[model samples]
Target: MKQSLLEVKGLRVAFGDKEVVHGIDFQIDQGEKLALVGESGSGKTVTALSLLRLAQNADVTGVANFAGEEGGAARDLLALPESKLRGIRGKEIAMIFQEPMTALNALYPVGDQIAEVLELHQALSARAAHEAAVQLLADTGIPEPARRARAFPHQLSGGQRQRAMIAMALACRPRLLLADEPTTALDVTVRAQILDLLTDLQRRYGMAVLLITHDLNLVRRFADRVAVMENGHLIEHGAVATVFDAPRHPYTRKLIDSRPQRDVAPVTARQAEPVLAAKSLRVIYPVPRPGFAGWFRKGEFVAVRGADFRIAPGETLGVVGESGSGKSTLALAALGLLKHQGELDVAGRRWNAGGASDRALRRVMQVVFQDPFSSLSPRMTVEQIVGEGLTVHAPELDAAARRTRSLDVLGQVGLTEAQFPALLDRYPHEFSGGQRQRLAVARALIVDPKLLVLDEPTSALDVTIQKQVLGLLQRLQRERGLSYLLITHDVEVIRAMAHQVIVMKDGAILESGPVGQVLDAPGHPYTQKLVAAALAD
Candidate 1:
């Protein structure tokens, strides 16, 4: 057996009087990949941060014995002095944090950021570090590394920003790497690429990896060993295949069964009217021309070009694509939020150009955005957030009637005063991600819209919560005959909810057909690649 690289025993983390992480024991073998799996607030992240003493205002205790050099004796990381620990950080053990958009400094160029790490830990000169930074970017499979390194974080794509973060983490060739939800915000193809990069780097560096994530599919494809956490306790630990195939703990079993299940019934043969229809829909933005021609005319960039689709009553038409693919642009055009060149009608009513919004048409169609927390106003209470529509659409209703209507819709979305005391009076931040999403759904349903534009509704939620939300949407569709124009990049979500699917790439629909036809046996090469990427794990 390989020697243990890190052995953690009786690890505890607490903030104030609330103990979030209970004492846990685990170990990592040299060159091995171990995944820590759990939902949000499960204490997996706290455990990882505590090892490096990164958690602020928190009390951490236990023994983290790390073997140093090639054959040197083990040392307790918890008892080390601050100065000594700083030397080991980013040199012997490094971390790749989630959300590279917020993690990377927006002020500095990506190349300069990578060079900073090389200068700090490796003591390389500025000129040497800059060149090495570009090489590191190339090693991570980034295209145009020399040019990309000089670009700011905001100027890069999501995948490119994440690659820059990975390049910085690998600059020092650390012995151990900690990756926290590395691929959560990435598209399916980019997620696969990042996973492959990590595997390759691990083999070249012979570094033991401690991956903290809730994605079971990623663990199945990437990790050798797995540890399951619930609340603050480590409930299960074993080989990935063993724990996944036959989970002993009930919590683990629940997580395994949390994958989205298809419950959508077949469309009836009633020949119902189409809720939404678009023909040759195009959205273009004007950009300033280059230096010589700037004063003459602006350049035109077509965001959504020649898109055509329809959503029938009681049906879901899913738009699947990566970021900047114009899926969101199509959603905005359908909601009458953006100006378009072609025809887009909701409930057979066209949007009035350069005029007041049609009140009746507005009440017939509503939208739910991607992030529920941000979409919902922080200053508004649950009653105000969910019932805001009534003020404009149903102004004749008295205060008592509005309250009753808000409570009714809230109950339909599975939230009630019984489950949450004074539910209508509470704020958005007072609830969990799942609960906030439910509120968003209730707000959309409150207006009794015939069509709902759902933009990445479940992208920001945990697996179990996503499953629940999808199930709720399915139930509402059956009960209320709701039509949905679902936009997202997750293939699993499309398979579980969509009756018909449209594959988008670079502002064009590459393929459109039934979910089984497009996802199971895709005709287009791009569509095939997307399906293959989703199933790669």
Candidate 2:
């Protein structure tokens, strides 16, 4: 029989007394795509990092045998010396982390970063590295590669940065690639493209891949084998088709059952008026050309064009689109943050285009951005963070009153103010990704807003936590008679919450109707393509 490229026997990883990865075993043949899927704190990332001896401050033990001529005969990855392990990092194994914003260097140009990897792994000169980097960028579908290569990490969009990460990981042509939630934060369109790129690269290079993710949609489409993990245990493992179609373990079955489906409930009477309305909304910017020196000239760019929509009370209107499709642009415009030509109304009140005195509307309309870490202020305590809006609107409340109110609201969002005082007084980095998102939701809820604009609120969360948040949102809408204008690329979230669905592409509305009708018989080809892309597996 042909030898496996990588094998694990009774592998275990622990941090102090807490053992995160239990004794588990798996093997991957050459060119195989194996997915490690589970909820947050399930130890998937820890296990993936172990392959390259990359676990951060953790004690790992087991037999990790990297067979083939490349892995230096017999020394296990856990037993390898630092010098020997350093050589394997880029050349033998590579990883594309989940958050490119945190993983990438903000100060450096993306192209230079990719070039740095090539120079480190291969004997490439400065000039040669530059050319190779440009090719890599172009290969990853970055338009205007040469110009984009010169741009810093902040200049590019989220999808563009993720693609740049892929370029860097593949630049080394490693024997094995570890992709940890590679497309979790990407838009559906960009996610599909990235998945395609990885598959194509796998075929072209014949490199074994360990795709660590919670996205079952990705697993069905791309993975060869699926391993289900729960609380640091491998619950089940089998062929991708079998596992997805007929998951044996209860946890795995629960995961499959939890996947959102198109709403079958009948639409009810629209009793309440729309909380938010937008018509002919257009946001345009005159960007500079490639060779231009200044941010001038008629580049003829439009972020959002003629975006017309409404979110009624007690209903969720989902804006579904890929990255750069102007979904967030529409949200920002509705908040009066961006200058645009449009008619906007929130809770029967006309939006003031003067960008002044949005206090009344702010109280009625609140927003939850994608990244809670960036959205929440680090310096302020949880009381200040959640009560800032309340203080601005109702300044009569003193610090003590505000703290009491903040604690009450935090409890509403499944967080105990007493048990989580560390979170209340601490910074964004102190809380986990899921906890931070819940805090963001709590802040929005503190305003008692009639309408909430949730822009990819659960994109960064793990699957189990995502389900909890979705359930919480549904309950909030029912109890408070609240409305939501949910902007997301996640089809599942839309399925779970959206009463009305609007599909947008290239700043134009592709289709919009009742969720049942739109999802069942999509009228527009673009909408059909989106549904197809989402349900591709």
Candidate 3:
């Protein structure tokens, strides 16, 4: 029989006078992949962090018995001395955070970061540690591992950086791994690759794993056993297949069924003129060349390669691609934020490079950014933030009129004074993520824009919250006949919200057609690969 690698009993976490995580129990068998799944604020992440005594300002109490790496005597992690726990961390047990950019040191090369782990845990010399770091990166499937080892965190792409993080985490061949939302920030194909790599590494190293995430599709893909949490409570747990097939808890069932579904209207005839149109549109950037050429001239990099598309009134055109694929560049060009070649028109009028005449079209095109918190001003109140657009598009409106329009628009996006007393007075940080996004949408709507550029609008939201926001957008579109240029990497979202879809890769459109046709029967191999990845998830 397989022995339990780690077992927890009566785990409780508190911050000052307020307790967040109630008592909970769970166990991971040796070489097992156990997933702790829940939405934001479910205490899943806190529970895992507290197990390692890494949660700052947190008081953790529990019995976390961890078997030694070589199957020797077990120790209570919760009761271990800080010095002893440090020895265990990154050696007997390690962690991979959700965002590699923040977790990885920006100043040092990723190789040094991995080498640092090896030096601390394995007691290896600097030279030996550095050599081993390159090997580790290679094992994680990074290309040109030796060269990549010298590159800093920001220099590497998202997937490459994440792979480096995994290599560092696994450097000492830990007995157990705690991965907190490891693939949440990754693209679909990259997410699948990471999961597969982790599975292979776990089998090779014979290490048990605790996967913490809000994504159920990932849990289904990666876990053997599943434990669901809700608002700091452990709601249910069982084998992955058993729980998914017959979820006993309401929250568990809801999560399982929360994958975005096609809820918008079908693609209709494009009889009307397109609100936004672009033909053979291209965007380029200049980069300094190394050595001799750099002194005199710079080389050019094409961001968007002759892209052509359109979005009629009440229609949605989704542009899906991986990071650095230039979907964002196309959106920027469409928004008149970039210089582009070829013909591009908004409402049958061209952008005169930010001329006063372009201001007229700006009112017809407003955008909702990906991260609402960062995009929104922290110092600005809801009234100011939402009404700021009005000053540009509707300058005739006074403060009182602007405030009234802001409140009405907010109410339209599902925010109201009844729900949030003095809603206009609150700042961005004062609201939840979903509420903040609602404010962003309300801000755009207050200008009475005919089109919206949604740049991964729900990518930062929780699953249920994503559904709510998408529903709200769909409702508003149906009522207001709004056109949307939706930019995202989520195929499920594209399937749900978009009428027309374009698959982009390396700054070029690989496929373009109705969502049903492209998603259901993709003609391009890359599109097929994307569709397959989404299906696997």
Best by TM-score: 2
Better of 1 and 3 by TM-score: 3
lDDT of 3 by residue, 225-327 (tens): 9999998899999999999999999998888777776667654548778898999999998865778979999999898999989888889999998766788
Clashing pairs in 1: none
Candidate 2: C-alpha lDDT:
0.82
Clashes of each: 0, 0, 0
What is the clash tally of candidate 3? 0
Cα error of candidate 2 at position 2, Å: 3.4
Clashing residue pairs in candidate 3 are none
Give the C-alpha lDDT of model 1.
0.88
lDDT of 2 by residue, 456-524 (tens): 888877777788788878777777888888999887688888999898887888889888788878988
C-alpha positional error of residue 228 in candidate 2 after TM-score superposition, expressed in Å: 1.8
What do the candidate models score in CA lDDT, each in turn? 0.88, 0.82, 0.88
Q: What CA RMSD would candidate 3 show?
A: 3.3
After superposing candidate 1 on the true structure, give the runs of residues whose Cα lies further than 4 Å from its correct spot. 1-3, 54-57, 67-92, 100-168, 269-271, 285-300, 337-339, 352-355, 358-363, 373-406, 425-430
RMSD of 1: 3.6
TM-score of each: 0.86, 0.90, 0.87
